[model samples]
Target: MTDRKLLLRVTLGWFLLLILAYLNHFQNGFHFDDSHTITYNTAIRNIKNVPAFFSDPTMFSANPQHHHLRPWVTTTLAVDYWLGGGLYPFFFHLSTFLVHIGLCLLLFSVYKEITGNALQHRWAPWIALFAAGVFGMHTAVAETINYVISRSDVWSTFFIVLSLFLFIRFPAKRKYGLYILAAVAGVFAKETVPVLLVLLFFYILFFEKNLSVAQLFTARHFKTVLGVVGRLLPLLLAVAIVQIYTLTRVNTETQDAGLSNPLISYWLTQTYVWFRYFITFFWPFHLSADTDLKVISDVSNWRIIVGVLFVMALLVSIVKTSARKETRPISFGLIWFAASLLPTSLLPFSEVMNDHRMYFAFTGLALAIVYAAGLLVIRRESSVVAHPSYKKAIIFAMALIIGLHAFGVHQRNKVWFTEETLWKDVTEKSPENGRGWMNYGLSLMSRGDYVSALKMFEKANTLLTDYSFLNINMAIANAGLKRNEEAVANFARAIMLAPNDYNSYAYYARYLVEQQKFAPAKEMAEKALSLNKNDIISLESAMAAYQGLQQWDKLKQTASYTLSIDPENTKAANYLAAAHQQKATVALPSSGLKTSEDYINLSLVLYNAGAYEDCIAACRNALALKPDNADAYNNICAAYNMLKQWDKAKEACKKALELNPNHANAPANLKWAENERL
Candidate 1:
């Protein structure tokens, strides 16, 4: 077959394989960072927030600690939210699926550029196909593909490859502008683009001329080297400008402990981490959504020794292979792996190893494996398609390898099916990880398994103490279990640990309301609202606390504010009606109130005063003023019930229930009227 036709056909095959491998993931729930980054992130609720996403660093995450200038990533998430209706995981997963496909296609384009030169542009399509397919199916990338927030990695790598493709496909002055723009976009996508500068330089030094550093300096290719460096200077300068901006934002908002380990210790531990990265590419049997891998404190550890030797051997092999004309692609692939990992290796994050970190680097590993196979076939002195047996063997091996990766991808996605399943996997795989246990406990709490959740929280606390949210969750579990004293202590501790955390305060307020501590609960709820005005949980707590305190006006105001934010909120509607009802029932007969706020409130007062006809007339007035007022429907229900109008009362109550499913008294009132005799 012609190369063009082969390329198209193989690309189509890779896409089909990707679909089959990832289609199941479309139903996967949001896990880990998805909660803070996408689920609770208010910025994604409106596309109008897109501009703020660029201007406000905190727009990217619900958690202030995660604030940074990842506007492109946040903007895409906002697009997903607008498309999905709201927090429906389908659109988020679909976006991730599409991104993976895009990365695969870009991988094909990049490999075609890199290998087209090395393989005389003959077997370039097949090599490109192999590399893209393997990388796309590799289990190491599943975390990025399944977790919606990890699009930072996806987009960054996409633009990095795109920049490289542009530079390779169009090296002229006109195309350089577009290339530089892509490089800049990549920097905004993630902090990994600076490494692209080195990758571009190495590409020119190795594949473009098929020469080593020694050969380039041997007088023949010195000017060529200088020319490549001069060409890359503009792109490097652009990346540098972005890096300064990104670093400033990251440093400003970074609330996490700067480095969990010393710089030298973290650097030394990356030796084994790189080895682990390599194993994941070839055999990803030990993939986990969350890992608790330890940092290597001692350089003389056996694993570090083996890892260093393994790395040295790979570097030596790359150097040896680059001397041969047919083996330069393999050398480039090995170098690509190390270069891609350079950014993560240089910095120490909270986690020593993260599977998402391998998403881009694994591309290099896949390339090396595919190109090495291609080189073996070439070394056999046979045309790629001439030797039927050799070609069949290579095809079979490729299918087997690709099939393994596909199976792993499919299995890995299943673990990400829900928060419970994912965290359960984390706890099982990394038992010592406090965060994993805590998240698992949260999942349990969400499931209403409060007793079990408390146990898990207790276990997690042994490993990690002083996390404010953890204490809040533990308090919630205690409240659920009816351990009021324990609940109060934990709630107080949570508030002390994180006074600014609205959730901690809100949940504490909820617990206090349950204990009938109305005044304190109201105070906590108000504090929570002050911290975050849009916090719906705090708003709900405030409404509940006002109801418990018998502060009818405050309850009505809080409920009205909540309903303005979410017009369909049943709980707020219930609170609003209950507040008016309580105020009407408790007012003195001799009270000389001048005017009601609305006809609904007047009807409520008249109904309580036993003026049934007047109450009915007032409700009619309310309905005339505001036709769909659920509170008016509920007030009429109460008035009809008082007048022994069974059928009328039942009808009004049903209407109220239809308008506000959360009207707490409507169902009972309707049932009472339905059972009454005519």
Candidate 2:
């Protein structure tokens, strides 16, 4: 093939690999791990969420808590809600793929630009094509690119690349107005992309030496200033609108996972995480949804090594490149990678090594890799005259490395197909990864596979055994198997591990209620309650323990409090009503409440008790509350059937069908009622 065709062929090869990534992922639905991004994520499921999402930073908080709130990332999902309805995950993956490709293209452009003069543009396209393809298909990006929830990384990187590309070209054209506006557009997509400012500053200092960072920030001397401003006006408008919307509507409601340690603890933790990151980037075999990495509370022995190496890498890249001047761009790219990583490296973020953290930083690593390889190739070829054999060998070596990377990427993509597979694969690959085992255990527990989960937790305990959550999950698994003693043991162990907000106390206390050990259960439950009174699950368990112990007054108070916390929970309300009934002078709140749902559920709960009158009464209340409640209407028909009121049953059944023809219970009840009418 001609050189142009050859470059096209190579680009096609990389594109083919990208296709494989999508193909591997396409059949896989959004796993339960990332399910909230579509279903429960308040921000992304609807446009109504937009006003709330922008208003609450805590609502969109993407930290290690209830979830990494990703408002900007999930806002796209909200848009997807209208565009495709139930096919949100499908479109979500599609958008992510396009964004990934866009990012790859930008990375390629950067490499191609940096090395353009190296081979007179002959090698630029191939290098760019290879870099983009490699970055796109690399397994290291599976967490950020393939996993649905990690779209924060994808969203952030998309803007980062766009901003960087626009800024890079701005210098060559000296039309700052248009591209700077583009960079600002990027900042809206993710706060992380603003770090591009430092990257841009580095690129100019190391690569584009003619332009200073301050000069690029302001360019009044540009000939096309007015024209540039005009070209950029629309982008400027869009960014300003998003900013205004964010400021006006947004709240700091994005919840973060609480951290006990100070910021310095996070910084110290990054030493270990940074080392782990380097190891994983070079060897992308095992990955986890969560890794149980230990924090270095103190700067001690091994951490000193990690900390020193990190410092050396940063200083060397900065000093060595600036000294040579010729090697400055590579230095800039290296420093950019390290600098971009700093925010996550424990400076501000509590996370040590978020895969998304690598999104922009990895480009620097890739650039450094390509630049180093290019330099090595040129230096070696300078002394040796190339023969046919040498040219073939060079191509073969490049192909081998690329082929190996592709195989690894392909293998890694499979692990991301499900959470269990991902954690299992991570633990297997990263045997020393304590967090990997903990996550794998949790994934196993999710499926009710507690036996296997216990083993995984034990392994994690052996690794980062001091942590409390491992004990909590292990206790949960024990409770699932009805191993009460083991469950209690694990729960107590967890409480001892941290002495704070213990899930173990809650679990053991619930098991104690099941065993009729109310006294101990009440004591433990109260402690758990004191830690988090609003925890619905624990509150329900605690109230049950009180009810079983015949602490009627206490039960009434606790159950009422639980209902207040979660007004939608009929059980809590039911418990409170029962507690009130015990006092002969006070009548219980009607078993059914204002909700059609409450009436329907009350009817079901009473159906087995031969309480046909009460069931019918509850169904009537439900119908009265929600005239079109299909389930209530259907159940009313069922209640009538029990009472042998066939004509009334048939009539009520018809109303149910009219309201919800496809209602599961309605159809079954309708068939039964019709058979009776016949």
Candidate 3:
């Protein structure tokens, strides 16, 4: 086959296999970060917000506090939204898949270029195909592909690879503009793009036949080093300025809170983290959306010691092997792997280890493996082919490795199929992970399995202690279980811990309304609205409080506002209906017994206020003028029921039935009164 035809076949095979592996994931809903960055981000709802996305970090999400400067990521989401007209998972997943395929094709091209020019000219196309295959099918990449938000990682990889390709193709000073463009685009996608500079440096060092490492450190090579730096200075400065701007725009409060662990401890923890990352690339069985890795303060810990030795061994091996012309690719691949991992390992992130972090770094590992395999089949003479037996064995080995990785990728997609499955797997794999248990509880709560959800939250608490959101979730579960006091206290604690989170106040307000604490519920709901005016939950909570307080005007206004924003909101629709009904009921009995309607309304207001006896007296006044009024008798019965005056309730129900035998609520009231009569 011609080189072009081979490339086409390999690219198609990569896409087809990738589609089959992640076929089930097209319908998967948004997970953790997707909620904040995509689902709730109202700014991306319209294409008009595109300019705002560039100007303000807050426009990246609905949460004003979640400041992200990744305008490219948000712009892409806006494009998706514009194309699909809303939050469609299929479109998002499809876009991500396309980007992955692009990355794979790019990888194949770069590999073919590198391998074809090597000292031992092997079947370069085959080497490129297998390397790209390994990377495209690596199970660790499942997190990045399935997660719509982690497209940031994918986007960064696309630019990083493109920039390297450009640099490799055009290493002269004049063609640096295209390289700078790719790097800048990458920086907009993610801050880690600056590492491309180091990558370019390495590529120039090993591939360009420039100054070798030994000579560069001595005085004689100082001028050579200066020449290289001068050539790349413009590209380096552009990336550095972009990095600085990106850093300044980050929300420091969130960053500091996430990196609460001391810097030294975080650095030490990454030693073992690198070890975990390496094994996952090859074996890839142990994977979780979230992991519970502990910090290793003790340098003598077994895992840390092993990690140290592994790094030392890898460096020594790469150096020793680099003398052989055939092993240069392996040497460069090792360096690339170490360099790619440097940013995530050295920096303190909220997570100790994230599978998506391996997305870019895995390419280097794949390169090393593929090049080593090529060595087994490639003859020393550029024109000669290897023996059939050696070729067959090498091909079989490559097939087996790629097959395992493909299987893992397919299985891993199932874990990311839903929030429930993802978190459940996390809990099972890392039982001590508090966030995993908490997220699992949230998934259960979404399914309305409150009892089970409560158990998960309680388990999470045992491990995580007092995170504000955890407390908020616990409060929600308690409210579900009718553990009112505990729910209220937990909500209060959540508010105290993270006073600015609108969700805590909104949920607490709803719980307060359930407990008939209308005053506090109204207060909390207003506070929640103050925090996030567009919060639908907070709007609903405030409307519920208004309904309970019989504040018809406020209820009508709040409900209408909610309905205008979300026309499909059932709660807002119900609230609006009740408000209108109450308003009409208040304006009733225009002549003889107008006082009765007024008194009935007063009785309801008093009943909501928990003044049961006062409500009963008001009902009696309504009954005085309109002795046969069914609503008056029904109101009296409801007040008596509230006071547990069952006999009185039974008598009132009897009168209501005598006045209007088919009164809507009379039979149920009579049954309840009879059952509990004392």
- In lDDT terms, which candidate is top? 1
TM-score to native of every candidate shown: 0.80, 0.65, 0.79
- Give per-model CA RMSD: 10.1, 9.1, 15.0
As for candidate 3, its clashing pairs are: none
Arranged by TM-score with the best first, the candidates are 1, 3, 2
Candidate 1 residue-wise lDDT, 1-678, digit = tens = 887887788668767877898878988988887887887676777677787776677677766567778888988888987787577888988887787788788888888877777778466678778888888887778878998788888999889888878887776743438978988988877888887887788888887666874586677788888898997888888899887886576535344434667788787788888988887777787878788887888888998897788888888988887787667777777887888888878878667888898988887778888888776766674565677887787778888888887778888889999889999999998998888999999999998999999989999999889888889889888888888889889988988988777778888877777777888888988998887665667787788878877888888788767754443344665666667676423433232112222555656655765657656765775575467777777777777888888889989998999899998888888887888834
Ranking by lDDT: 1, 3, 2
Q: Count the backbone clashes (under 3 Å) in each candidate.
A: 0, 22, 0
For lDDT, candidate 1 versus 2, the one ahead is 1
The C-alpha stretches of model 2 lying farther than 4 A from their native spots are: 27-43, 58-69, 79-91, 117-121, 170-190, 207-303, 306-310, 323-326, 346-351, 354-356, 379-385, 429-435, 458-472, 484-678
Candidate 3 per-residue lDDT over residues 1-678, each given as its tens digit: 887787677668667777787788888889998997888676676576787776578767666566778999999998997677577888888898899989987888787766665644437777878888889988788889998989999999899998877777665744639978898989988878877877777666566654344554779867767777787788899998887887687666543335556678778778778878888876687788888887778888898887887788778766755655556677777777878888877767767888888888888878887787677556443333345665566657766776676777778778888889999999998887999999999999998899999899899999988789999999888888888888889988998988878878988888887788888999999999887776777888898889888998898789767754443354664566567566423322233223567667656755665657656765776776578789888878887887888998999999999989999998898888888873
| lDDT on C-alpha atoms for all candidate structures | 0.78, 0.65, 0.78
lDDT of 2 by residue, 83-108 (tens): 66444456777777787877887778
Candidate 1 pairs with clashing backbones: none
